[model samples]
Each structure stands twice: as structure tokens, then as C-alpha cells.
Target: AVANVCGFIASTLHRGIGLIHFPTTLLAQCDASISHKQAVNAPHGKNLVGSYYAPIRIIVDTDVLQTLEDWLLPDGMGEIVKHALCQDVDLLTYLEEYDGALNDPVFLDYIVRRTIELKCEVIDIDPKENKEAVVLIYGHTLGHPIESISHRMGTACCLSHGQAVAIGCVIAARVAFLMGLAEESIIERTEQICAKYDLPYLIPADQSVDRIMSKLPFNKTWTKEGTMMALIERPGKVFNFDGHFKCPVDDATIRRAVEQTMAPFGTIIKGSGSSGALRKNKLSNGDLASSTITTPIGSPMEKPGEGWAVSAGGSCPKGDC
Candidate 1:
């Protein structure tokens, strides 16, 4: 998000500043840099302080991606999968059928361009994200809170942005299926793609669902009526209410979906337990295979990373290198 901030700084200071972006990471190349929006995370919430300032130009350099840690390659694919869910099933099909190595630079460049094309299509319809573009945030409603709250907690390592969003996409799909907004196939396909990419499909044990609930109100999707969520009907189709892509959701309903998502795989959790504790933490494939690594990407904090080598999860890489 250093590039995101620089774009923001350029907007805040000058007449466009003729700012140009040379996005290096898969995350930026595929999703972050394509947007006309330039924002940074805040102590209060994600992307809370920012503006919509289009860059003069954005150049994707897949060659720069040669140095990205292998663990980081999948980081951008979360958004790509999300784009497929929002409006491109063929893209999803390609990813599902592909068996090649993800480390292939050729593959990386292809997917990056593909993701940018999808994002641009959405941006063309709603450049400001006030309408259709919000669909691009398919996983972020719950994902943001999960990532944000995880950062504040100390018991477990924080979930990377990709991991958090991957889980968030599953939750949104599952919630849609629960609400009858989507069919069971939607949920299954969502989970299947996430698992295929090796993205985390389960919430970490360290996170509190209630805490996640508390943070929902701060979401930008909120209106005086309540929060709205981005749910999909099928691959390439988002659930639309009236003329819009999101629908207003109540606390009781959203909480139910969140709890159900946190529940063990196929077991639908009833209400919270009688004694005020949650149901038995029945760990499944997700929990069983999960790895809680120290932040793989120490990026985009409200406070900029100081010179090189601040620390493991908080240090700036430029300083270390």
C-alpha cells in the first residue's frame, strides 16, 4: 500500500502531479493499482482516510514480481477470485482447471492483466464505488473487520490481507446461501476456488466473532438504516436488490451468518450455546491445515514503517534491503 499512499499524497498536494504507478506486487498489479481510488488504512478502519484520485498511468511490471516471496503470490489471487464471482465465470473456470505452477512468471503476468481487465470493467460502471464498483469488495465487508481486529489482537499472528479476504469471500457466499440469495452451488464453488488457491477458508481461533460484530458498524457500507453487504447469486452475477448490487442486512441475520461461518464445516450452528460460550470448536480441514505465521507482509499501517528493518511484522523492507 506504499504505492496506494503515494497516489493519495499526489492527489492531496498537486494538480494530479502527473502521478504514474509502476506496481510490482501481484496484489497491486491485479487489484489495488487498477482503481482510481487511492486510500490508506487507518487506526479507526481500513481505507478510512483517503481520496479517489486516478493515477496518470499505471504500469504493471511482472518482472519485478520475480522477487516476491512464494507465499505472497496467492495474496493477489483472492481479488481475482472475487472478480470471477462478481462478473467472470470463465476466469474462475480457468483457475479451477489450471494445474501449472503459480510461480510461473508467464502465468502471473496473464492473471494480472486478466484481473485488471475485470476491475476496469467494474470501474467503468461505477468509478467511485458508490454502486456497481462496490461489488468488487465482495469479500471485504467481513474481511476488513477480520483483518483489522486481528491486527489489534496479540494472541495469534495476524492474518495476511489475502488470507482474511479469502475467508471473507467464503463467509459472504455462505451467508448468501443461508439467506436464499444464492444457491448451494454458489457456496460450494466459492469454497472450492478458495481452497484451490490455498487461501484460508476458516476464521482463526484467536478472533472473536463478537468483536468482529462490533466493528461492522464502522464499515463504509453503513447507512442510517444499517449496513449493506455484497452477496453473489452465481459466478459472474452479484445479488442485486432493486437497481443496486448490495442489500441492507440486519444484525440478527448477519450475526447468524457470521456464527455459521465460524462453525465447523457442515454443521449448522444453532444459536450460541446455553451457557454463553460458543459451540464446541470443531476444527475441520480448514482449522487442521491452518498456519499462523507472523505477518508475511508488514504493510499499510496508519503509521508508516520507519526506515529499514523496524521489526518482523512491522518493519519496512526498504530499510532492511
Candidate 2:
């Protein structure tokens, strides 16, 4: 939090070079390096106080991802899948076809570049996240709360930010389907892609619906009127009823979506271990069995020994080390 404040201040004070080195695939695919956003957590919710300050340049070192455990790969895939679902249909197809190649450095680099490119296009159009860029928050409405609550509950490793967002995407897709905005097939496909990537397609039974619902009002997306959500109409399209990209979704509808998404996973949650069938399925596929450590969300810098460490040389002036 202190570093975020300092970075924001630095960006405001001078035009210094801001270089970001993303170690994990999650950081590369998600907001860690690509976005202009800087945020700090508030007492009420996450990222309640934030500003827009684009980095001078962002660097993603795919070579560092070789050390990333298998469970951690899905953290990055959540954002990759989110971007593909919101903008690139071909990216989605690529992910579906090559889900098993997540550990491949070449493939990982390609997907990371694609995800960054998609976000860059959105940021180029709407740097402030008011219009076109707002769609980038596709699954984040529910995803954020799940992430924060899970972290507070000491279950951050079990439900990483990416895992939560993947499930959140499924929930948002279901809501879109129920609202007649998206097709049933899209929801199924979303679930299948999440499953293929070893992501959770349903809400975990341990996550309290009431607790999740209580956090909705405190979301950073909330306005004076209500909470704004990025609902989808299709895989490569966002639902825009009015001129705005974000639509004001009522609490009741949100609750319904949460309930519906969680309904099917009850048996799996109860029958299998706390890790759920998803972990079992991933294990069956010969993926790594080790659990993952917690990572910072949307923050570029991490504690030493947590993520990839900087080289012995000084800071990277350009994106290249």
C-alpha cells in the first residue's frame, strides 16, 4: 500500500520511467503491468481509493514463468480468458485448443502478448475506465469481493484472484444468459473453458453468499445510484443497452446469479475434498499437485522471495532488462 501511494505520487510529480517486470502469467495477462490504474484498499472495500497512472513501459519475462507452479498458472488464465471472452474470439479458440500447453513458455508468451494487446486497445480508447475500457472489468464485480473475503479468511491460496475471477466470469455469463442478453451456449462454453484451464466454474461452498452479497455495495464500481457491472452479450461482445458500457445491475439480479452459479457445485463441494473436483480433474490430467502461494493483486512489486527477483544489475530503464 505504501508503495502504491509512492508510485502514484511519483507519477503525479514527474514523468519518470516506470518499468514493470511481470513474473507470473497471471500478472502478465491481468492488470499488474498493462493498465494505468493504481489503487489502495479502503476499510469498506478493495481499490476504493485509486488513480490512473500508466506506466511508461511494461515488461513481461516469460522465462521466469518456468518456475511457476501449475496451480498458479490458472491465476493468469482467468484474466486471459476474461480478455478473450470480452474482445478476441480467436484468442478464446486458441485458449480452448491449447489449454494443456499452459506451461509452455512459447505459448504462454503468445497468450500474454495477446492479453496485453487487447487491454492496450481498450486503454488506448478509454484510459480512465469510463467507457470502452470499463468492459475490462467483465468478471471483476463479483471477483473482487470473492478475492478480498477469501484473503481475509486465510484461504487465499485455495481461491486465488484468478480462480475467483474465472468463477466470477461464469456467474456473469449466467446472469447475461438469464437476462436474455447472451445465449445458453456461451455460458456452457465459458464453464468448459474454465474447466479446461483448471479454474473454478462455480462458487465454492465455503464462500458465504450473504458475506459476498454484503460486500457488493462497497465495490469500487458502485456509484451514487447503484453498482455498475459489465455484463456480456456474447463471447466477443459486451451488452450495452444504453450508451454506457457499464449497466446498473440490481442487487436482486446479482443475488440470483450468485445462487444459480453456486447451486450445481454443492454436491461436488460436499462429496469431494475442500479443493473440489476441479483440482481432482487437474490432477488427473497430469498437472502439478503442489499448492500455490498467495500473490498480490494488481500490484506490480512483490516482497522479496515471493515472486521473481530482480537481476543483480540496477533497475530496468527500458522494458528490457
User: Which residue pairs in model 2 clash with each other?
Assistant: 26-76
- TM-scores for all predictions: 0.80, 0.76
lDDT of 2 by residue, 110-215 (tens): 8877887898898998998889998789998998876666544112134666777888899889778777788899989999998888788777544556677788
Per residue, candidate 1 scores C-alpha lDDT tens digits across 1-321 of 768899889888855676788888788888778888888888767888888888878888898888987667777777788888878888888889989998787888788888888889879888988788878888999989877765542323346677678879988887788788888888778888987887777665445567778778788897767678888888888888899888887777767767666633222212111111111232223332223212334333232211112334343333121
**What 10-residue stretch in candidate 2 is worst by lDDT?**
302-311
Relative to the true structure, candidate 2 has a C-alpha RMSD (angstroms) of 13.1
Q: Candidate 2 — what's its lDDT?
A: 0.68
lDDT of each: 0.71, 0.68
Residue 79's C-alpha lDDT in candidate 1? 79
